[model samples]
Target: MTISLNKTIAYTKNWKPTFWIALVLGVLLSLLLITLEPFDNSNSFSNKYFILSGYTLCILIPVLLVHPIENYFYTLQTNRWYIINEILYVVSTLFIIFLFSFLYHFYVVSGLSSFTFASIWDFIKDYGVPFIPIVVPLWVYLRSKYGVIEVPLYDKENHKKRTSVTITGNNKSETLTIFESDFVFARAQQNYVDIYFNTESGMQQKTFRSTLSNIMKQLPTAWQVHRSYLVNLDYLTAVEGNARKRFMKISKTEETIPISQIYYRALGKRLSNSPQELQN
Candidate 1:
């Protein structure tokens, strides 16, 4: 049952910003880091290095760790829960940074005293505290441009013309000649998309060297009814329910597509909104 909540999630998919916003944020953060208070006996050059290092470790680590986890949750279509996980991951990363710094000073960094609760608390307040919160959203924004949170879509709006796409696999190149109407569905098969389509003669299958999300955008306005499946909205002629999956009956074909539970709502909504009414 492709239903309400799923449609909401699909519409919000691919909420990535333009490149200019990322470029501006990067410049601002760099400038902010350059102007922070200096430590005693540290030259401007060395201070810059310390700030960069702190920013990288304290800020970047959390982002790097959390991004994959975020994607996993997004694939599961658990949007709200993923947001919660991101917040907890960021907070936890900040604590880890503080703990590691204290340990380093005590056991490694010379000219520093043994770790203490008061010192650790002060260090967190001084450095780890201010930098962590500022970095997560900026990183998320930048990374989203790379297709991180995007969902797959295909439908009639893109069905007219033949699209020539190059597919490379095993260091070899192959050309995929397709019209948006010819495609029935596609799936992310490991590093590639396993595509199902139709020709003037009969059904056909091909492997393409691209992700499902990337391929989805090129498709006509079909909704992604499963994390792995992108079906042509026009082809969805009938839907039959099953305990685990809903079998989708497509136009002019008896082959039914499987609709995963996660995408049911989004797919249903797209079907309800006649594809002819959707603006290209």
Candidate 2:
């Protein structure tokens, strides 16, 4: 269990998803409060709506503030993010929301004048205890739905030394040879792999009656970015997109290759250390 919790997972850093998740949570919480009529003192519908707005803001403000701050730290040490990190993020954000909600309740809903430690403790029992059961599971579900696992970085130096590579098909006679530096990317077709490489004349493609995995073993520098594509890091020029959707651009090719989420972190880390110019 400890080892499982310590395993690394993709940390969501994009603001768009953060905003949407907070918005949805706020809306849902507001609706639940409205239906339940949790606060009997706010009997008047207008007052209830105003109080609900405060509750919604409490949820939204903490989440939006916490996510970016956490993301900044995550960026500094990208590889260290794990399941435990995510759990702590969610719990810390919830604690902040609880503090905000407690203050709002003390000043506005309850119309209390004194702000004491005891009152805060009392409010936690009244409010925070009930919220945990519902919110934690919901958070876990959302995280699993959106999260991705990161792959470990490959040795970038291994690919740099090799100048030429020979890819062989099922038959010995079927083979294509090219300079390793000139190799761009490879895509798997039905039963053949299309190899793209640079030539003095122009960019060229050679089809081999072989699988992508078979081709990958021959090229030490090639990385399988997706199920159907293997890219040569030597030719990778740019990487773009948010946590959910990412694309890579090769130096000599106009085509953009889709990067699978599992490979995204490893690719970014590899490119940042590479001599090639990588535009994110």
Best by TM-score: 2
Tens-place lDDT digits, model 1, residues 1-280: 5322222232122324323433444445445655664234335343445544443343334334445655565556433233344445446654765676555434433246565689888766875567656755664555433423233334453556576443344434645666656677777777678777778788788887866555655554435666677776656665679767687777645666787765565456545565443322
Clash totals, every prediction: 12, 0
Model 2 TM-score (2 dp): 0.54
Query: In candidate 1, which residue ranges exceed 4 Å CA deviation?
Result: 1-158, 161-170, 188-192, 209-223, 242-244, 275-280
Q: After superposition, how far is residue 67 of candidate 1 from its true place, in Å?
A: 20
Root-mean-square deviation of each candidate, in angstroms?
13.0, 11.9
Candidate 2 deviant stretches above 4 angstroms = 1-3, 44-46, 148-280
Query: Model 2 over residues 127-242: C-alpha lDDT tens digits?
Result: 67787787667766665556544433443564445578788998788888887867889999878899998788988998889877678768755667887898876667778999
Q: How accurate locally is residue 135 in candidate 2, as Cα lDDT from 0 to 100?
A: 66
TM-score for candidate 1, residues paired by index: 0.42
Give all TM-scores, in the order shown: 0.42, 0.54
Q: Model 2 clash pairs?
A: none
